[model samples]
Target: MSHPTAPPPYEDHNPLYPGPPRPGGYGQPSVLPGGYPAYPTYPQPGYGHPAGYPQPVPPVHPMPMNYGHDYSEEERAGSDSFGEWDNRKVRHTFIQKVYCIISVQLLITVAIIAIFTFVEPVSEYVRNNVAVYYVSYAVFLATYLILACCQGPRRRFPWNIILLTVFTLALGFMTGTISSMYETKAVIIAMIITAVVAIAVTIFCFQTKVDFTSCTGLFCVLGIVLMVTGIVTSIVLLFRYIYWLHMVYAALGAICFTLFLAYDTQVVLGNRKHTISPEDYITGALQIYTDIVYIFTFVLQLVGNRD
Candidate 1:
């Protein structure tokens, strides 16, 4: 090889590209490294060039803003959201249909209970107090409240649903047959009240969309208070103390209970953390069902007393 070339003379030094920060006024024109393919340089139209050149315009549209990292990524996210929405809609729809079927089932159960009471040629007193029928109702309501609202005693929802169904069916059947102090007209009035409360509470749930999860603890405390108050009032009434005050307490209790039902139902329907199973649907139906039935029965008793 030839001897190594000496450092270039002062005027001959050709530094390769002068490194990045150019010395002249051309401070690297904010371009991407290769200048975006040079944007097609235009030639001057003098010297017999196409002077009247009708230059076709470059297309001005930008490449789409990539919301996704890849095509499959966008597609996957879109399909997931759509699928979740669709699944929820279908679940609610099927639940509603199932609710209707269960309602019919309850009515059939009531008819059976009623037939047993009347066709059995049983005494009226025996038919009336027949082995703590109302206690089953209390258990059903408590079961629903627990299942619909709480996360503690998990997986009991399905058993609770079956129990409530059996209880209501039994109640309906018995109530249909036996003679009672309250008339059907009174019951009808109660039904209307219950229905109104349900609708109002549901509308409130939808319109507000407020998170009331904190109120859950307060509700439990209040339920205990109501139970204790009812027991005390029952004892007092047994001693021949006519306390209309207890009725007022009960009326307010009913109102609170109605709101609770609505809020709880909304949570099951929309609360993301509360994954509603098929049993939850049954539980929800049971909640509304009891709310309606009791409010109806209560109002019926009060109305029928107008003699």
Candidate 2:
């Protein structure tokens, strides 16, 4: 028997829902009224995707990492502190060396002065031999020029020490001869005054914020003025030795050299606009020694009673 004829393919023939039939079948895609393709087909793995469909996202790549070594906080701090400590140590050592040399030089000079001032024979010999004083002065000038102008000789190992020794001896002899001309009591008083003034000036230079190094030009001008005054005074003295005029010259000299001592001390300290290099310990010692000695000489002249 003919099985009940298969129900005709179901169709919604309702009048209210009218449209063109699906091209493929009930379960397949169909074109729209605008003649465009039905829902876009998925692209193959290697092919371009149809527009408007969510595109297959490109495979994501992670960012590259930094592999360089980084310093830890402790290591960085240690390195910084080490550098500062090393610098301070070097500066301290330089200062110590300079001061030690100066101390030795001063001791030698003081001993010479004492022998010349207190000892009868030495004092007479130094005084009678005026040529020796001139010779010592010449030696002092030559050695000073070599040390100040020739870096090679100044920095040479044993040679620098030798030159400095010779220079110190020459200067000491000259200073002692000058001391011989002064009364013992006056020399002692002048020595005390020089010591006091030198110590005071050094303390002030280290403590004060005022930078004397910045006044290099002023120092030069003052130096020139002092030199001119000294020349005029020398000429006046040759014509007639006026006690007041000589005293005035000595006073001016003492003041000028006192300022120089302060300047040189600050330079050696290396905390100012003008600082001696750490490598130039010899130069630093030389400058400071000269300033101090000059201070003593000028003070002696200012206050000492001539024998």
Candidate 3:
């Protein structure tokens, strides 16, 4: 069979047939071979049906959806930068406030100890009233424990600040009484050492990438070990005379609590992924205070000149 030749293009100026009514409109492009439209139909009638054949749409570049609001360039840039700046400022303020609370608590605790250590009448009274000291210590510790473990909206607002202040004061009283039993020189030295170590650990937690928060399980185990060791050491000191044993116990306790200080600092900093919230400043201060107390206690034991 002979091959059929292609038909000539439909001309709009043809005198014979007037070119099929100008392919659906005047000034519109002619439909090309195989029913493809030749020109863009943007801003024209029959937009989707140009020249009776579907016009190849210029690929409508839809505006990126902005959660339904049409934000201008400056508005979008300002919003993004403002959001980042606000987050950074919030974190900075939170850290500063938390540290300020911690510093105040530390000062209160240290002042209590200094009062008891330096004041002759207060030291004598605490030394003489053994029963009262024990009672007050037990009461303060129980109060702190209950308040610390309790979690609710009460732990949120003004209640948290009030409770934490009370806890700090009570703990300071207990610590002052206990420190009074130690030699003044030992107490002062221990305080200095504890302060230095705390400062160093706080700096390390802030600067280092080591995520001490991940060792929660390890800390719990160490806490249990310390408790058992404390019980055994207390019993030994109570029933038997062992100076070296006391020293060893004190040294071990100091080591454990220093680690705890580092861990708690990391949690308080809230920089790591497993960090405590900035809102938990009360808890953070409590943790750091407890670590410092234990550190001081152990250091005092190691340095105290026992009669």
Q: Find the candidate with the highest TM-score and give its number.
A: 2
Per-residue accuracy of model 2 over 1-307 as CA lDDT, tens digit each: 3432222244643333354543222322333444444443333232234332353354333433545756678867765434333477787898899999999999999999999999999998887889989999999999999999999999989989999999999999999999999999988888899889988998998799988889999888879988999999999999999999988888888888888888888887765677777778999899888888888888888888887
Clashes of each: 9, 0, 0
How well does model 2 score by local distance difference test?
0.80
Which of the numbered candidates is closest to the native, going by highest lDDT? 2
Measured by TM-score, how close is model 3 to the native structure? 0.71
Residue 172 local lDDT, model 2: 92
> Which residue window of length 10 is worst by lDDT in model 3?
16-25
Model 1: ten consecutive residues of lowest lDDT: 22-31
lDDT tens readout by residue for model 3, 1-307: 5522322255533353254433333334444445554565323344335444554555333456556878788878866334433376676776787778878988899899999989999889888888767776777787677657877632668777777777788878888988888888888888899889888988888789988778889989999998999899899889997989889889989999999999988776665545655556677777888888889888888888742
Candidate 1 structure quality by residue, lDDT tens digits, 1-307: 4532332233432243243432211222323344332132233333234462344355444556666555576667765434343476766774575468556754664455444434444435444575544664566456556655665432464665465566565455444433243444554465567667767876776677565544677777767887787787778887885647556655756765765666565555554333345445555565556555554444444445421
Q: How far does residue 282 in candidate 3 sit from its true spot (Å)?
A: 0.9
Considering summed lDDT, which 10 consecutive residues are worst modelled in model 2?
22-31
Tell me the spans in candidate 3 whose CA falls farther than 4 Å from its real position: 1-86
